[model samples]
Target: MEITFYQEVDSTNSEAKRLVDGGKAPGFAVVAKRQTAGRGRFDRVWQTPTGNLALTFAIPAPPSRPDLPTLALMTGLALHNVLQPLLGDRAQVKIKWPNDMLVNGHKVSGTLIERVGKVLYIGVGVNLVSRPENVPYETFSLAEVVNITVEELAEAVTAHWSATLAQWLETGFAPLCDDYNAHLYGRGESLRISLDRERAEWAEGTCTGVTPEGHICLADSEGHVTRYNAGDIDIIRTLQSV
Candidate 1:
């Protein structure tokens, strides 16, 4: 495992890609204190403060990316494992499907996974000391929720991720699905999901659990169960929002 730090960069994910092109092997972690052009899925800009947390690590590609859902879920579980302790036993530190990490409905962290050649790059950004303004949804900072420093939180997340990665590699998602579902945000709530694009259309359903393969299980009002792919989902809090 190799770690590199940059005071500032255009984006940690981009930096990781560049390093990979420069012959950096898998398991190389690239972290930056600030990003001039941070981004997330759907080409949205990520508003993370300097000195907060922008971590991107590379892993060798699996036989297939079919397990990406499990990969993302495990990453969220890793963050939850490190954060739930700080939030106490009763707090709702949960993962919003596909990307967002929510603590009591407020997003504190998020992850992005991309495949480049034979390696997969996992990019994560956590709000430590600052939060963005005018976001589509609510956001939170670790400083507001807990008193820990970004460095401490980063170390904890990394350790948890390492352990979770091993567990996933050994047992796959079957053993982790229950654990992932337990911390899933809006698990049993009525949600309006737009598949493919955020601005695409809306479909309302009751949130069901996840599949062993990582697709979200949703039960429609007609009592039919449907499983959707892990990524390319836009969740609306209320049906009226659709």
Candidate 2:
């Protein structure tokens, strides 16, 4: 793993993409102390402060290009896999569809992906000690919630990231869907989802996991399953925005 550490940067994803476009290999991680212009899924501004984990990894050889969404989901699963043990049952790590990490119905971390040519840059921002100011949703850090240091959590993420990426590349999204579905938030519950433009679209029943193509499956009150590709979605009961 080749990691480039920075005291601060605009966005690690952008930097890593620049490297990949210039012919960098996979397994390269770019970390920043502060992200002046961090972003989340759907191009939303992710206000992350110093000391949080802002990492973007480049994957030079993906099994398929359109499978990038599944790859991002797998990456979030890896993050959850490493942190859930430390969180135990208290924090309740639930994975939002695509790539958002929630704790106790509140968001603690988010992931984004940008693909250039065949190389992919997967960006992740986890609130480690503090939340970005005036953020719409409630956020928690691993240290604040679970009493662990940032370095320890970062080390754990780095170690699992490699393994997770390899699995995603080889086996595709089946394993990822199973693992992520097991840790899903509000698996069988009535919920309102924000489909587009933050309009609250009500859906009842349970989460039936995702298709291999990386769509969110929400079984409605009428027993009809609706799949979401990517956009704004939140678990309505807790008002937890994802």
lDDT of each: 0.78, 0.76
| Per-residue lDDT over 1-242 for candidate 1, one digit per residue giving the tens place of the 0 to 100 score | 56787888998899999988888778878888788898887788987678678989888887765676678878877888888897785456887885568876778887888888788899999888788878867778777657876566767777778888988988898898888888887678776666556556656678887888888878887889888774433355543320
lDDT of 2 by residue, 30-144 (tens): 8887899999765789877878888888767555456766777787789889878888877788887666888876778888887776677778888887876677777777766
Weakest 10 consecutive residues, lDDT, candidate 2? 196-205
TM agreement with the true structure for every prediction? 0.91, 0.88
RMSD of 1: 2.3
After superposition, which runs of candidate 1 have C-alpha atoms over 4 Å from their true positions?
89-91, 230-242
Q: Which candidate is the best by lDDT?
A: 1
Query: In model 2, which regions exceed 4 Å deviation?
Result: 21-23, 61-66, 147-149, 197-205, 238-240
- Roughly what TM-score does model 1 have, to 2 decimal places? 0.91
* Per-residue error (Å), model 1, residue 114: 0.7
